[model samples]
Target: MKHLNSQSFLEDSLKRKVIFLTGKGGVGKTAVAWATALTLSRNKRKVRLISWSPFESFSEPTTLKSLGITWHQLEAAACFKEYALKTLKFEKFFDAVFENRVLKAFIEVAPGLSETVIAGKVWDLFDRGEQDTLVVDLPATGHALSFFKSPMGIEKMFATGFVHRQAGNICDMFVDPYTRVDIVTLPEEMPLVESGQFVEHLMGLGKFHLGFLWLNQCTPDLKVPDKIPSTLDKSIRECLEDHRFRLEREAKNLVEAKKMPLVVKKIPKFSSEAVKETIEQIAAHMEEK
Candidate 1:
């Protein structure tokens, strides 16, 4: 069931050219990100789905190969090299200067460099107008905070160079009207708490358009029957009991989510495994007008 302020659920999410999905680890952000991308593609929106986290099963290439969406994984080393090439303005110049093994290793270990590279990459692609939409599955809450902070650091350090300019451009994407930072969460304790904390943190930073708080894997509410049919098998009864317990838990969590300052949109739980079809089901929900 949808929660408070759920109107325009898909519209508010899709209005942004770049939507960043983030939440606590294991909160199913990647699933929602892929599903949202799939919906965009099916609707004839040119979309690119990017993931910064480690390899996830949802990003399996074969599943998305026929979906008409461009899938990209942004690694620190590669993105940094791409940034270097753009700055140096020549492949030969980049190969000669940044070819050193020491610098390459540093790229992997540099603090917040991954975050910077990611923002820079997206900025370049958006500026180039390569696609109509970019759906990014960002790292968990803490890492995402670093991403929001990285560009300002780059601007301060370089002060006056290609890096500084690019950093400003990256920063621009954060406060831009078409950029969104959406949170995905399960109907549980820690995920809900962290979602609140993440928003509190955002308040102290640059103006970022807060989109929907995607309540992932919610169980559909069912009316409590006055009596259970004793004719059912024992194991089936046990499964029904479990379902009731989950519904109770989800109802309480939904109440908690509404208290937050963000609009809560829900995605009903589907298969036990997050397979290709699960994504397709979610895509359909996201396509709802």
Candidate 2:
């Protein structure tokens, strides 16, 4: 892959309000997401890290916890209860209405209603206006797409009332150009293929701004020795040639990404302990001209 600096693509040196990171599972998306959040926080930006993983807990991974950035694990059940209580607090009449077992049961039974509740809570967080940057460790590509589109989809199904208002507000936040969608991927073939398809799907929606295509765990593009050993077996020589060709192909893809409307970020393969350092490297790359 092309081993260029990260800052080359971040055209705007100013602060970013929101950055969403996503990719296929087990591709280092979460690590990159947390690392990026910490790197931005070091610049004195108020950063919040969120994970939508169903199985994950409120406690962030040790790497992220050590950074001291605010990490939120969004659990649907907890979010629903929090939202319901807040709504009830605001409208005593609603509390009285919900007091009726039938009304409460109806809301619980409604299809897609649970998703709407979660969207409303997410909107409330966005609207609170405290943090400058929100780094979301979103679900896999498909689930993330659904999460983002939840507001709009639910709005259409239930067109009138607070739900509609909440969805409208959330949609505005999403469509903002400053909001960036960062797709994390490995240098391997499958992840890149999925990332490409995800990009295509995002484009088809004509919604949301894609910030960058991040190829993580990239094998560094190292310079070869000046002279090859003549004694090397033919098969070994062919393998070396193939490796070089593959690297060249990756470099071409990076160039193509550079030409796109959004920027592209590349991170080389490193051990987990180096995650923070990697993020710093990424931030430094992004800070470049």
Candidate 3:
């Protein structure tokens, strides 16, 4: 119901301990997450940026260290290992149990075990209070939603045990007011449609707050004269016409975005630059808002 500019959005985000950024694939969710982390870091917050994926492995972004934000790439195997080590309190015991082929095979066969372990790792980060902020560049929409909901699935699947407790803890963190989910989307029909459905799904989960809807790469409004000069070249006029059509389409998408209840922020299309520079530019714009 309320609208927020970049500045207010950043300010509001600073109040949350954890922020999960997600959207359709190739919608620039990672870039927005990096910019949000950098903005918080620049404001003197102790921030950590986490890249989370279920199937694929990831390397930490090199730019994170330069921006003074701690970085971690979350993988199921690594998280499971760390959780096992901590709980068992002995590396030898963990290795013996986990390294056993039968147990390992059973774990691999478990439907949501891997996802639960990864969620536990994220929960541990939040529970430990090691950092002021955690920014999660989550996987795309379907996987991301399942990732967040893994805790609940685990709870139902396991009546009581360490896994169940871990699930409960992660679910608690997820439903807490301090944890926010930010959805990033393009100013296009399919993305907006998916975003709206995702928001409703999150709401259905109950108490999982939808923080912001980021409309990235929005076409900037062009100030053009009502009457085209007869002296203008034909090719130039055609280009102008194309630009006008794009602007019109963007306007319709924006109207649809504004109709949603969540706070919306438009990130302008930036010029091609190095990844670090682009993140910096986005951060600057966030501050300006």
Candidate 4:
């Protein structure tokens, strides 16, 4: 319910060891995640940005290293392999078991194993104290909800074992006050609706510490004089009217977003900037605020 400026919001969010940034697709969640990591690193915090991808290929942006933020791309298979090695305690045994063709295939097709392992790896990082902060760029709303819920499902399914224990630990982190989730979305109809629904869904789960909602790529409101220049062409006048309408729509969506449970922060539209520059600009905006 608080109207927080960017700096204060970032400070408060950093209190949580793990911050998950997620919302509908194409809402600039990854950009916000990178910005947050950069901002935290600039404050001298040891920060790590983790991006979840379902594919085999992974790459870290060189800009992250320049900002002093460690970056990791998490894939389910790799995470599962690491988790198995740690839990099984014998590299040889793990490789023999997980490397088998049929077993590997079965494990891959296992209902919630991948999701469980990914979530567990994140908790492992949080528990290991390897970094001051872990910023996760999660998938879209539906997949993210499933990712966070995987721990509980695994805990119930396993009942008693290392997997159960791991799931339980991750679930504990979920309910911890210091673990927060930030939902990011654009100031438009579909994203706003999904964000509101996502907030309600997280609340219904009764676990996560919903941190805030970010309204990204918001059009700035520009003032127009009552008396317009008569020399202006008709196309220019129409373009100005259209721009004003978009701004008004963005404002209305923002109002609706504020009605949700968490604080809402707006990121002005930066359409022309490259990825790295956009991240830096967002970080600067947070610093200034």
Candidate 5:
């Protein structure tokens, strides 16, 4: 992959209409998303961070309190309420149509419909001109695709009139150029492979405009032989040589930068607070345009 600094790639991505951060679980997508939101807010842009995890609350004020940003949890109850109001606003007729006992019973029983309603609410957020930047802390790999592809799936699964129209409208939000996808990964083998698959899947969706390949927890290069060879037995020398070779393998790949996807490489590891710091670094690079 092309050598990337988070600062530059992030700065460039911010120019797009919508910016999405996604990846397999435990890859730090949420932290990076929060950091992006915080950095954009500090740049004086109106921002909102939305989390879709039902079990975990996104109420950590300390995460962005210093940066003057708020994280909103998209719990089921709140989503249902927001969905009801937004639907009522979209078509005044729905105010009464959705009130029927039969329809209410359907929504109550088929919770999947409730998920569709939440998707509609997300589409509305983009339409309402509420904020300059909207950061979505999406579900992990297994469900993130469903969240983005739900409208299309609903349209196909239920080939009716009203529902089809609604799905079409929701799909429109995703197809717009303002939206894009970013997948986070580690340098290790499995995550890297999964990240590649995520990128390929997003490309298949055709709705994601900007694709970001973020390699997190990267070990900083100890290039140029920074450490002198140790005075040790032959076996230790062989081990050190192996370590040095592994570190420089990718650096050698940089020779053909244009052919590879740009990567935002972060630190190997850090504490929770480091999340913000890493994001800040990314946002700073994103601003370099």
Candidate 6:
């Protein structure tokens, strides 16, 4: 696999069939995913961006529609129903099985059932080879661990059967050359700590390859005067001090992050609040080679 840097990320994204974007909650991972998908779509590659939840304020479906990218929600129950229908190959049998209260209760409490089915859906989607790229905005930190590990759990639980086979396939796909994960994180202590630990666990699994570590909402290094005027007002001074503090934290975290064996890139805090502009900027940044 190519050792991808920020410069190569955008181009390399096209090379992968699936890219998962995940990080701590509220770190703008979704925006990065959308931008990546949008970039591919603009390049005339068929791209689909998958979300697990309903559209939040930032993810405007109309914008995706206008950009020629498909947006989809890959919910667990829905995907499970789809997979069961295909696997069982009989709608009546599916209804009969699901209609039984005991079976339904068993399904509700079954370990890894939801995650495996979701992973199965992902595998099925890729198996079809219908899209040029599938960009999944995966769940935040802890849930993401379960997302990738579900197949392994299922494989261990089922010694032989279609589910066993499917679980093994998902595991293979996890390490496939065409699949990778990119993480977005803030430079703050809590987020960085969580991200570092997450990376450790992820690498320990050895099932997935990390692509990029994106520093989101970053304040770019700027040439500021050595000191604020002595006459500056208290609030202004506070603001300047806050900016300086952020820069210091960013630098410290960046140094620590760079020590990791992965490419780290920063997505700067935007002056403009326009969602379209933010995505476009990130897309442009990712496209840099």
User: What local distance difference test score does each model get?
Assistant: 0.79, 0.68, 0.82, 0.80, 0.63, 0.79
What is the per-residue lDDT of model 1 for residues 89-192, given as tens digits with 9 covering 90 to 100? Answer: 76754475666889877776776677788888888888887888899888889888888888867777666877677788888888788887789999998899
lDDT tens per residue, model 3, 213-279: 8899877776656776778999988878777888889889999988876788888888766778888
Instruction: Determine the backbone clash count of candidate 2.
Output: 4
Q: Alpha-carbon error at 256 in model 6, in Å? A: 1.3
TM-score head-to-head 3 vs 6, winner:
3
TM-score of 3: 0.92
Question: Residue by residue across 1-289, what tens digits does model 2's lDDT show?
Answer: 3222234443331345677788998887877787677667776778888777645544446656666778877766556556766764555455565457775566556655555665566567777868877887888887777767667677787878666667777777776766777888866667777787887777666566676677776657775554666789998777777767767777866765565445566787654456656666665544543
Which residue pairs in model 4 clash with each other?
none
Candidate 5 lDDT, tens digit per residue, 1-289? 3322343544654554556677788887876777677667777778888777635554567757765776666655456555656544656555565557776666656635655665676666777868887777777776777677667678777878555678887787776766766666666667766766665676578645545565665555555455646777788778667767766654443332223354444434443356457666655544544
What local lDDT does model 3 show for residue 64? 73
| Winner by TM-score | 3
lDDT at 66, model 4: 68
Greater-lDDT candidate between 1 and 5: 1
Candidate number achieving the greatest lDDT relative to the actual structure: 3
TM-score of 2: 0.77
Candidate structures ordered by TM-score, highest first: 3, 4, 1, 6, 2, 5
lDDT of 4 by residue, 61-142 (tens): 6777766678888877768778777787757555766667876676678877777888888888999988988999888898
TM-score of candidate 5 to 2 decimals:
0.75
Off by over 4 Å in 5: 1-11, 57-59, 89-115, 161-163, 224-227, 232-246, 249-289
Decide which is better by lDDT, 2 or 6: 6
Each model's number of backbone clashes? 0, 4, 1, 0, 8, 0
Clashes of 3: 1
Question: Lowest summed-lDDT stretch of 10 residues in model 5?
Answer: 251-260
Indicate the worst ten consecutive residues by lDDT in candidate 2: 1-10
